[model samples]
Target: MKKSVTILFAFIISQFQAQPGNYYQQSAKYKMNIDVDAEKFTYQGEQTLEYTNNSPDELKVVYFHLYWNAFKPNSMMDQRVSGQGKNGDSRLQKDGVSRLASIPKNEEGSQNIHWIKQNGKELKFEIQETIMKVYLAESIKPNSTTTFTMDWDAVIPQQIRRSGRNNREGVDMTMTQWYPKIAEYDYDGWATFDYIGREFHAPFADFEVAIKINKDYVIGAGGILENPQGVKGYESKPLLSIDKNNKVTWRWTAKNILDFAWSADKDYKVKSFDVPEGPKVFLVYQQNNKTKAWEEAQPYVTKYFQIMNSHFGKYIYPTYTFIQGGDGGMEYGMCTMILGEAQNIKDLMGLMAHEGAHSWYQQMLATNESMRPWMDEGFTSYAEGYTMHQLFPEDLPNPFIKTLDSYRAFIKKGIEEPAVWLGDHHDNGSAYTYASYVKGELYLVQLGYIMGEQKLAEVLKQYYDQWSMRHPSDRDFLHIAQKVSGMDLKWFHNYWINTTKTIDYGIKDIKYDTKSTTIILINKGQVPMPIDFSVMTTDKKIITYQIPLNMTHTWKDKDMYGDFSTMPYWPWTQKEYTLTIPYTKSQLYVLGIDFSQRIADINMSDNFIEVK
Candidate 1:
């Protein structure tokens, strides 16, 4: 019987290891074809994709994104356009042209052609969708390869957001997202969506892109240059071709990348540094407006790159560029577009640190930004806070230590809102950004406190390794957290992500018996954050206990499980907790719940109890 049980256990372990969702077990591959022209600052290209369907079921359709459409007039994205100002009118008045309104509407299209093989005969299929589609492509066999061709065109928008055309005198025009690209389709089906001034999730693929530009222009893209010997303005030369009009053509090939972007300029100042055992760091900023501050900022940005690479996984790309453009700091694969202005050294470092960290969440992990914006944006925001706390400890705000102050400030002004709202559905224009960015970071900080920092970091690394270049829902995150913490956290999730409840627990009553001392603690708020309770005896000895509760998703009662023999660790909840101290009635004591105010307890009036 023992021998049979051992054999069965081995079989089950092997089966578990063979599951398709195990990203670490299998290698994901992609290939792309891109061609660009610098004269008109636009791109027309074909992407040949070969995806390995590792899943169990057959996939019938694929999705592609036309993100430039978000900049169109009368679009949903057009409603929230503004410039640097406190009020909407000030932003409008400062810049007569609404950035969204300035996007060129005439140049965006994509078509997918399917390959068919029947009875030794080869055929092709074509289908096109304005936004996205479910086409009848050949069923991709399990653990096999299916190849398709996509042709697209993108007219570069005038530098608005991160991806666009930037025309500078004596400088080469920098163009990005100058072509339509296919979106990702997996267990969740099509993931095509318009750009909504938020995060981005792209499908992983290899890229072989060639651009034609003037001979004087120098181009940089997501990958290394294949053939630099080709003459300007020709298509039939070699691997990839360029055209005349002094336009330089660039051909790029990338492997295991989700998206592609490139920049070009005749006068671009290119600088490179080797990162030990990692990708090379490149700085591509124009020298026209460069200053001493700018020169000093580059090293700071590079330091952040080192910090992020060490904390997260290795930087996978061969090179990363810090290009100057757009309104502020934004991230592209293997490159970041940053605005060239900062008030002080701290401000400059902060911007660089935040943007560089995006490479981990937005680029490396590549979570879908449309549906689960919180995963990329919120997670990155949390990382930003963490990085800031580590790098600029004196200047940055400590979310864990100042949770109460944050809650009080938000509540006292009556600006408190449910943190569960959709990323694009907030009433005010900036509210969504603030909540998703700041509040989301706070949530992670609080989670770190609940489940020790080391455990939280482990879970984060696990999450990135598992879901990189894949789509994971909100539930997936909670599931991973539960597995990492070894505790069921459904109640925590429901309260934190699904409701607007606040946390307010305090001492309700105190009494002493001749044999022992007893105190009653009451939860005063609807929200149920884990609690910490501390009490002092008349002799000045302190005691602490942690109380676990069921308030968010469950209503069951059970004894809390945690070591309470320590002096400073206590947990309380929405319900009352009764504590019996091992002391006599002659002793007097003072009791406090969440004495450090780290849990953001909304009310403190009931936190203290006196016993005589």
Candidate 2:
């Protein structure tokens, strides 16, 4: 009994020590019943929110995000669209005019609260555009729970962004970020921001939602249907197309998820498939000649699951739905909504692969994507490229190079914001796309080159295991990488994310005596990274040399390009390096820096030279 008690005590200490400093995440149980008038594009809802303050500090007030309220004219999102001028989101513009600026009164969306009560006492509140601040009737004590109930009405805007009705793809609804979500509170306090058609940060909570809509419309959603017996053929077949005036109440429940989204269409066709040792996948899309590719790409999604599970991380959710949604793809909770119509199978599979990876990163490893969009968007893009490579080898051997090429083009454009910028704060749409998706993907690819690729693979899986169902900042991800690689990586993450500096390395010079050949490498860019220099011999043999960065304190335990001789450390301050090998120039055919092309070297023209 004494030995057992000692082991148990040590285990508890170890688990506590592994957590981030002062890390406490609060959550709530949201029980809601909504009635939708499909023709009017309006809804009424009643909410019962049971919130708990897990943080050490007591809570005097709380906030909620009224997302649809941004759809009105002169809103912050409308002004932001006009402010970006020609560089704003194209979807939000119509012939150089902001779409929201001229929306019709009835079509415009808004959320109006009737009243809010905390434990049966009415609370005073203030509405700040899309955000609502509620002064508590009674202060919520730490480690204690409080129940609040409210009634509200909402108008669904015409399809413009993720949350809308009647999208370009003819998806009747793309209900995303559609609720009056309670803002997340943690060590950072209340995370409340206006809806600007950007990223989101949500608290993980259980939901018991009952939505009333027309019975004829087939509803596909992110949550499991709790009353499937009542609504027959919901999982595998289309519901009976009956009277539009008749309403059917769909009771859906989800546990430990941040949000729930559902789309309804009379034309939606459902197909179900299972991945071995993985989640059950539901393909719900409107079928037509344009959407034939969705059917052809069904098997590819299974392959994608296999690759992601084998490499990055396991899909923690039991079910994943690929429902046809708005104009483009958006991920939420256990499912993702994507456009079903694709010109080709590869394009369909590519989008599915991208959104599917989000199930692992964005959906489960729920980061405050508004703050660290790179980890959410970039990591998903990285996984997408890798999965596409496996599915279609003829397209490219190393798909990551394609993203590097895109990054180089954007770097040449001379407009790059730091990765630390919030998702909505980027000056232009291009900057946001490149930073969050293109360059963000390069962050992981470069890290793989810095630490061994195997180490990076381990780091991703460990990160998923530790940070899923919670919010992880960029620093949290970096700590996991440092732990897995057993190296000092602060310099790498800081330089890469905090600055717009580029990486440019070149072969400067080569000299040879009868017994030895020497090579000189130069760093032409501001960012400093370890070098993997390789040489080709007269006998057609390729030999690689690894130069460890001084600040890294060590070299990769395993190199993806195979084994190599460890060269002396290269100091970041030094502009050039001279390396000598015990071979004559006559025995060498060529010399190059990073033949794998994994490094995002902005200037690659001078990276290689013939020495024979």
Candidate 3:
């Protein structure tokens, strides 16, 4: 008994030590000056970055991301879109041919580095497509800071992907990933993957940006505007002051954000609304019949922040913007660039809800998204579904019903990859989209099924309070889940993320005796989950049973859908379990598993056995 107690104490300490705060992440501070030529559709900029090494290991090398370079013909992004053919992004292809290959040279995007210096000494650097690696002349020691300066120029591509100029909607520019951003280095080492038109990951840092452009343009950006009073659409609405150069310098600053993005258009209409106890909301879009949705969405946008904060957590930033510029909708630091045109009010509200929810998971949570796109996209989708249900309660039988069916169909195709696959490495774009977005949402929905719904909400709040603004990994999230639910979630995380497994449970047989009834439940799918079985008698009374997986070591305190008696643990190794209840055959109306419909059981047809 003494030895057992000692081991248990040691294990508890180890688990506590393994929590998220054990590791360190580097930080960056950037100051930039940019000059744009609207007619030529290009820009030149200079940057000075102060990088702090928080890791124990000394850094001998640094890398940067030249994201716009991927818009050039024959680039990796263009090739990937081409290779995927009909299975790839529909925007990149036109009638079975890659549109990137046919784009004119003037429309193709490119970035050129003029010079780079480290601590006043020129450094040797190489550009491999979208990534630039700089060999350090003086390595940065542990806990030391290094300064690097660079001068570069870029031609903004015609609006094809996220960052570009001259979009179809006539927005002048959408500047995201427009600068030569330093690559993030964490415990996993340098994440310098080439930009392949997918997700991104970057260090949490501060940005001070100054842009000199014609005074006629109105801009919406990620950070707080330092010169809002000088701009026409701001609160003061002061007259524009033009210098001899006929240009105005717009200054912006953001703190502890992973990325800085902005959009500019001469005709943009700027509007603002405030969320009570939350951030101020900004809507920047063109004024037209097509953009009427933007004006209508202001109230709904404010309500979204309130709903998300009351349920998920508080919005960390003081302001959020919904800009009209990008191809479809893309989330940024403090703003999201969404297509201005909306089919209707519901369509506009849906997009705003999804992108707004992304601020919690993508902007503040700051997960290494390229490594785990599901954590960002999936969690964002889950929040969006809930927000939509709240905003439009008329369609609230189950918001996740469509997502569950989508995941089941993808699984049936036998082509779905594990959710653990890198965001850009997935073989099929459709598979990647479904796996990361739909299946990832289902992961949370089903967890809410296993634990009670109220407990799941508490777990999410706990996670946000602990991990926000820190670069959290999958283990970090799962650890919070285990701590909150008091259930072992290792098996759950492994089966759902690291492998392509399916969940299918069915009522295989039913038997009646003189005093009671017996039912056989079978696990037809490889993946195992806690079971919620319900039996309805002829008199309309319902009885529910909870069968938890043995791996969890404990079951939920109560069922969310109805009252249920806790049954014995269902050992995953055993494919079938015999469940006995105190009811005769004549008393039975229907016997079903997971009547709540929260579980993603693929074989729902066999889930219920009904008697007339």
Ranked by TM-score, top first: 3, 2, 1
What is the per-residue lDDT of model 1 for residues 112-215, given as tens digits with 9 covering 90 to 100? Answer: 23333322234343333225453644665567666655555656655545556663223344445444455665555556555555556566666666565556
What are the RMSDs of all candidates, in order?
Answer: 7.3, 4.1, 4.2
How much is 15 displaced in model 1, in angstroms? Answer: 14
TM-score of each: 0.74, 0.94, 0.94
Collision count for each candidate, in order? 34, 0, 0
Candidate 2 per-residue lDDT over residues 84-191, each given as its tens digit: 877888888766578899888988988889999999999999999888999998899988999999999988898788778888888877787777889998766788
Q: Model 3, residue 555: displacement in angstroms? A: 0.8
How much does candidate 1 score in TM-score? 0.74
The regions of model 3 sitting more than 4 angstroms off are 1-21, 395-397, 513-515
Model 3, TM vs. native: 0.94
Local distance difference test values of all predictions, in order: 0.58, 0.85, 0.88
Candidate 3 or 1, higher TM-score: 3
lDDT of 3 at 139: 96
